[model samples]
Target: MTVFSVNHVTTYAYAEPVRLGEHRMMLRPRDSNDQRLLEASLAIDPPPKTLRWIHDVFDNCVAVATFSGETRELRVENRITLEHTPFEGDEFLLDDSARFYPFAYDAEETPDLARSIERHSPDPSGELDRWVRHFLHPGRPTETGELLMTLNYAIKEGFYYERRVEKGTQSALETLARRRGSCRDFATLMMEAARALGFAARFVSGYLYVPDCDGENRHLGGGSTHAWLQIYLPGSGWVEFDPTNGIVGNRDLIRVAVAREARQAIPLYGSYFADNATASTMDVEVRVRQSPSCELPSAPHRNL
Candidate 1:
């Protein structure tokens, strides 16, 4: 088990003072068998009149903040410490029934995964279908794990990784045609491709831990929030695939939220009201570093 500390800060500056609306924040990390939250704290500038926490439809923890006054600048900072157990790609063991491609999910599990398995984008030209089919051989059973790993690595090697400051992700088709996109775009493409192959997939938003070893950085899309996708396997459950970095499992990925669409898992979003004022600038910084030890304080913040 490795301990990690994450710090995320977002600042929005306006040309003039504006009344802020209720802001929804999805900055808290999920506690799972592989990940355990140890401590968490959140601080906002121009404090909100009220702040409350609730779980969304997907059971992701969200913070709702309502402001009563106006401010020219709004800043949100979140800090968290957790223990993460990495899962290597080769460690994934598929059930015998699901070891090969072209397999169907259990009838009992189909209902809940139906929505995820349904393709969301319209591929009138069948470009994505053709692209995803290249990984399989005609009239031959393909190893499911190998197929997925190859596809994941293909994205990283085939597409150009560009950093975009945009707010939303581009369509899978767009990314394919351009042959270049941000991490989220790659994730969307992978998710849609998996869905087309009759697999349940979801978008994951989180932070990436880029370790500095021997004065060298080891990962991409670090120093900011990252995006990836998860495919549901029978015995393996939801297996993570980060096409952006060609990572097959969780590794240094720290998940904050999961959703069918990227927009639903935005880390922070809100609106401001002002007749003449407009958002002048928006800045975000994320840091994920390994802690020296796994020690904890006497009392931990369980609600975070």
Candidate 2:
């Protein structure tokens, strides 16, 4: 079991001060088998007059608060200590998942996922077609660890991660054409690619305690969240892979929830416009610490 100190902070600033109104929040994590939640607390500047907690389709904690004016400042922070216990390692892949995920026998109406399979047909675009080709080729790797290592190298070898918010439902071909994507886009593309090749891949959203991230960092879930992809293999179970960063594993992944797509995994997301005008601003920060700075666990294998 690994112990970690995780903290997250998010604040928003408006272009101009206007009459503030009621605000809704979906900023808390829900229960899941992947990660255990120890404790959580939320603070809002110019505190809200009323707060009503609601659960979304994915069962995430959503809060609605009444505010008086525009330029409202909101902050959410969570402290959690959890362990991986039985991590899904290289051995798990060869025994169970390798056989189960590669066939389309188990696609169901999973309401929790935002991106649905509108239609299932052969992808003509070489984009996913190529990845599928690789996934299906003989000599498939023996474990999830090898899959992560191989994918990390492939993404880094193909393109670079620049700053930008990916828009719309891009076909696997479209993402392949661009060779660039946001956290959600990258993870989505990976999920599609995995599914195309017959793998049970899910989306995950939560905090990643990175030392280099300062003040406020851009969100993978974007706007108000962070996201990544998870693949289930036997014995190993579900393991996370951050195609954006190229290096996050059982040792680092602070999982909040696992669902079908980025939308379901978002921390705070809803649609509401008071008047004819639409307006919104978001801020986010993340911090990670280790007590005593004792001997570190084994470092993850480097990407090729």
Candidate 3:
């Protein structure tokens, strides 16, 4: 078992004082069978007038903060400690029916997963479909797990990792054309590609932990929030894949929220009302490290 502490700070600096509106944040890590949240706290400068927590359609915890006064700078800090049990890609066993490509999902589960399987981006040219087909050889059997892993690694090796501070994810076609993009862009591409292959794929937004020992092998998209995708497989359920780092399973990926599309999983967003007081700059800092002490009990704990 590994315990980790994550500190995330986001600040928005304006040209002058402005009336801040309600801000929604998704900084808390999700508690699952393999991962447990130990403790969490959030601090905001010029304290919010009211703060409330609610679960969205996807059952992700979201914090909504409303402010009354005005300030030139808006800052939000989140700290959390979690216990994670790593799972490797090879550990999962797929059902016999889904062990190979060109499989079908259970009839009952198809309804719920249909939206995820449907491609969100338009692929009129069938470019993305042709790209995904490369993993499957004609007139021969293809191992499902191997195909997915190869695709994940292909993105990491084939494309350049570009850090884009701008909002929104690029369409899969855009990433394919450039052969380079941010972590989210890579995730979006993988998600769309998997969907085209008749798989239920979702976008995951969270923090990634990189140990000091990694040194030269440190993962990319670490100093800030990271993005990845999960594909649902029979027997194994939803399996994670980080194309940006060629990571499989949960490993060092700490998930905060999951969405059918990237736009639905913004970490922090809000607007400020001001006249002629345009925003000047925005900065984000994230740090994820292994904790020195483990406080979780040996017995398995249920998610709260």
lDDT score, candidate 1: 0.89
Q: What lDDT tens digits, residue by residue, belong to model 2 across residues 186-235? A: 77777777666555677777656443234443223322345678765444
Model 1 steric clash pairs: none
Candidate 3 positional error at 241, Å: 0.2
After aligning candidate 3 to the native by TM-score, how far in Å is the CA of 243 from where it should be? 0.1
In model 2, which regions exceed 4 Å deviation? 19-26, 30-34, 68-72, 75-90, 93-126, 138-149, 165-172, 211-225, 234-236, 247-249, 270-281, 294-296, 300-304
Candidate 1 lDDT, tens digit per residue, 65-183? 99987899999999999999876333566789998998999999999999899999999989999999999978988889888888898999999999998778899999999999999
| lDDT minimum window of 10 residues, candidate 3 | 295-304
Deviation in Å, model 2, residue 304 alpha carbon: 18
Candidate 2 local Cα displacement, residue 103, angstroms: 5.1
Off by over 4 Å in 3: 88-90, 293-304
The superposed Cα distance between candidate 3 and the true structure at residue 288, in angstroms, equals 0.5
CA lDDT, every model vs. true structure = 0.89, 0.55, 0.89
What shift in Å separates residue 188 of candidate 2 from its native position after superposition? 0.9
Candidate 1 ranges with C-alpha deviation above 4 Å: 88-90, 293-304
lDDT of 2: 0.55
